[model samples]
Target chain A: MLTAIREKVLAGKRISDEDAMYLFASDDIFTLGALASHVAYRKNGRKAFFIRNRHVNPTNICVNRCKFCAFSRSQGQEGAFELTIDDIIGKLGKGQATKAKGMGKSRSPRSVHVSPHGFSEVHIVGGLHPDWPFEHYRNMLSAIRKRFPKLHIKAFTAVEIDYFSRISGRSLEDVLRALKQSGLGSMPGGGAEIFREEIRNRLCPEKIPGERWLEVMETAHRVGIRTNATMLYGHVEDLADRVDHLSRLRRLQDRTKGFQAFIPLAYHPKNTEIEGSYTSGIDDLKTMAVSRIFLDNFDHVKAYWIMLGEKISQLALLFGADDIDGTIIEEKITHSAGGLSGEKLTAGQLVNLIQKAGKVAVERDSFYKTVRVYP
Target chain B: MITQEDNSRISRKEALSLFKNADLLGLGMWADMARKGLHPEEICTFVVDRNINYTNVCINKCTFCAFWRDADDADAYLLDRETIFGKIEEAIAMGGTQILLQGGLHPNLDISFYVDLLRSVKERFDINVHGFSPPEICYIADASDLTIRETLSILKSAGLDSIPGGGAEILSDRVREVLSPKKIKSSRWLEVMEAAHRLGMRTTATMMFGSIETPEDIITHLDAIRQLQDRTGGFTAFIPWTFQPGNTELEETGRVERTKGRTARTSKLRVQSPATAVEYLRVLAISRIYLDNVDNIQASWVTQGLKTAQVALRFGANDFGSTMIEENVVAAAGVSYAVSTNDIIGAIRTAGFVPAQRDTHYNLLRFF
Candidate 1:
């Protein structure tokens, strides 16, 4: 069966779901990687891309308690805290002069530009705080955008967007439009824990359904906002479920051509309610390679080094992964879920890892614009 | 003939076999190993230069060129000395160390025209004059009724520092006959380069692939450069660029010949597909392994964009070619990828190497 699949691949035919299932079940990791590497080279040669961005999760309090999440806390939990707008501004390098300017803050004359960290984008996602109004979210984005007018703000996931719509008594489009007006540049690919209904029900029952997530993504695409697609694999999902998830993403890309990348998040099983071990490195590599093979129309495949360790991320370069997310200044979501990768990597360190993998490293912005290509 | 072994010089047959059946990743790894072995100081280099096409008027209307114009065309242009000097001044202001002076094979330009141009530029600027490919030199020699050596000597005395390898499209005469028959014969191009090398001038070797050339023909091209470099050791780098078919005579005539009532046989001569990125990297790696005598392999960012050119560093390229302050020929071919000095430095750093600015003779100017 593997031979048949390889033959089809070499003959320039698309691999069927059965072929993907067979590949998933195969024990020969080297052959699977080689097959996927052939496709990877066909798409992009020996180049792997990274970005220089900061991760800013604004709040950690949520209403729904998903089984696989360890980052959220109840309203008064010890570690649960929402950053005040001033706190967020302070983090962005505006000192205490503007801290007294209450909640009704207009874009002030851009205060002392402190740390030019060379960040091209800011990745913003957080828990759905029950008390804060939608206006708080809007103001947060607006303030951040005003502070760093040049940085691309990839804020909010589909799940958060859906929650905001329900809270604000508006349609999804209105909520997205309001956020866009507040300077939302794009959407992140999170809260998409395996698209299988059964698995989604078992893992994150109170979260948005898989269908609603797709609908929100389609609506975002219709409004000319591109987003990255993701699948949280290595959990209870079967091989068939994984293949189906990739196939659906591929079809969506066919219609919209808006997905910039497909990231297969490795499910870490340390602090969540799930009672199993972490997925092995073999499973992670195979998942990444299979996603690259399946999502042919998708322009990029990202191996979030925060989920997969630096070593595995380097190996993923040869296994059909072209992007190893970025510096991610302070990543909390992955670390809270028992991901042991560091909270940050220097641009120099990331470039070294990519170069050590014998691939050229390119630093990109959040929108996949080439910041630089390190030859 | 070179010997084929694990520790000896690679033979032509072994190199050809690598082109045919070597594993792509393994071949890339070996080529990169060879690059690191040759350039042990972890640095990638580029020159800040402008491709100054002095004129676009040409008599030999090669089918692959979109930058040429007839002498009588309304839009035809020949830059005057003032404009040329102004461009050089701008390039110097932008920290350019060299000017790649090339133009079409103009019908009536005598040797004195080139010598005077070289003299005026040298008199005004303290930059390197890397001018004239072999075909252009041949045209000038024929027009002036001088031998190739006399032509190169005269140009050298007039401040022509080096030569560019533009006309060696493919060293296989069979492919050259179909691709650029009117330009120059393969042997004549090699002869001109040999004459330049004998005059103690350094030159670069280039191969414009992805045309109607076979893998065997590509190997033959690399062999020609390798043998020449073995004899003269004057070739500084090897650059391989894809033949962009957009806005070319090939695309224009091949697509509309039938509409113009030409026979179907004429359209059959078209190159149907542009070479894909995978093909580009594969051949690029193979060229690095085959052209062992050439010290540098340059990535063509003008033909392949920044991303693939970045990837070329891993596939055995050690040079970013140039910052290309001003380029007209490849832009005329309808493929334009521009990069600044900072972009080149950033790309080189991202590729895990220090970036250095160099002169036309591969002399290190500065490291960024």
Candidate 2:
């Protein structure tokens, strides 16, 4: 069963949904990893991507309290708070200074800083505050843009975009264009937790449906704003649901070609209403490998270190993941839900992780453009 | 012309170089080839056993061990004969065929204590007693003023079936001096294994890497196992696991001090971060490729978890190790992954191998 799929992948042919399910079910994990590695190599060629990025959550006071989300809190909740534009900018500035100092001390003489701030990306995502206006999000982007013009602002999920459109009484296209004009370079993949409606309804009842999330992404891509896609696995969804989600994303990418990467977010089962344990290492690697093999149109598959932890994320590089996401200075979502990995990884540590896995570490920008390739 | 068999037996220098410079997936493929050459059938084996720690009180306060306790520590315990027998009885109820009886080196418990424990367990349970690692045996011998052979022979007569590969953490004296100053030295570990083999008792060997050991130290550990296995041909398996430094003293201090220039006390070897899954796979593959004489390479799901253990199938591990009805050593270090017999079977079957239940000696008893 795997041999036929292997032949198709090696020959640069697309695999069927059934073939992907077979790969997922089959016990040949090593071959699945090799196949994924082959496909990854064909696209990226031994170059593993990481970005010096900072994740800033503007608020935790979310209107939609998703079952699986330990990050979101109701308005006026004790732990719920929002970040002002100046507060976000101040955080980024302070983070940059601390990172620059650390990098200056530990970075080898051969590896030079690609960005002066020690990072090229600021990843912003947060809850759908009930009172915050669309102008608030637009102002936040423009303020960060005005402060650091060189820093690429890859912000917001499609769910947030959908919320902005509804809250402002505008269309999806108008909302996306407004954010882009406010200096949003790209979108981080979130909110597309799962495409199957049955699981989606149970997981995040008030959040936008998977179709709406895709619509927002397609709208963003059509407006010339490239974004990444994500699927939250190891929860209630089964193999078919996962494959269906990938198929939908691949179909949309075929039309828009907008998803720069596909990230399989491992469901961390802590402080959440969902009753589950952490996804086993096999499930994590198999998801990465299958995503690489099935989502052939997507240029990259990221092993998000925050959810997968450092060790499994490193192993995911060999299991068909070409990107380990980024040096997320402060990741609030996963951490709020009991993330096991450290909040931030130094650029040196990131390089060491990739290089020790026997691959070249390529520092990338928000769009995965090469910033620096460490030898 | 070099034959394929000769090529399979990698030299120590070659093994070290490969460990230093091999690509992760490439090394895995090579190890998979070696695994296929040994176990051509699509079958992976696991033993259903319970690790009954007779006592946690130990005089050898090894720095890396979280399972050891001082004689007066609040949680220190010595299991009674009834408890041990009852545990074995429960294990036999679950179709468990072996009892992994191992514990710390207690100063109070002499040879008579061990002999009686073995005899009592044997008298009750009709099961294989895979008891006593090299360190425990050496301790018993030293406490009883007996030789290693004599100690092992006495234990065997009391129905001790085999020796598990524990306490052989990085078979390098430099590492032992820093990580476990009070534990037996590397030579003594090997000597005990050799003595047990000479007495016609088959045993398993292990190496706990990913601590303070260097690449050279890892290769040295593997080579030592390979050399000993060649001589004795009694090592049924070689299990390599990462050192989980969670609750141990090693994690608290976060540095291994290595004395330099005889009198200099300032120099320190910075402790490395825990081994990543990639490093674990790399070393596992290397162990399988280098240790050609050893038949089984056990994947450590207890440390790496089930998924990585599944991936280990292609990394040259033909054995999924024991069901581990109860494991406290790694758990003491704050990392515990529990798996049932069905879970192991399901994992192996999904990983594309026929899962078989085996005895302590790696003999297949039943196929799932």
Model 2: how far is B89 from its true place, Å?
Answer: 7.3
The interface RMSD for candidate 1 is: 12.1
Error of 1 at A322 (Å): 12
DockQ each candidate and list the results: 0.01, 0.36
Where does model 1 exceed 4 Å of error?
Answer: A1-228, A231-261, A264-375, B1-4, B252-266
Report the lDDT tens digits of candidate 2 across residue range A59-161: 9988998999998888877899999888999888865543453445645544443333467789899999999999999999999989888889999999899
What is the i-RMS of every prediction? 12.1, 2.8
Candidate 1, residue A181: how far the Cα is off, in Å: 30
Superposed by TM-score, candidate 2 places the C-alpha of residue B127 at a distance from the truth, in angstroms, of 5.7
**DockQ for candidate 2:** 0.36
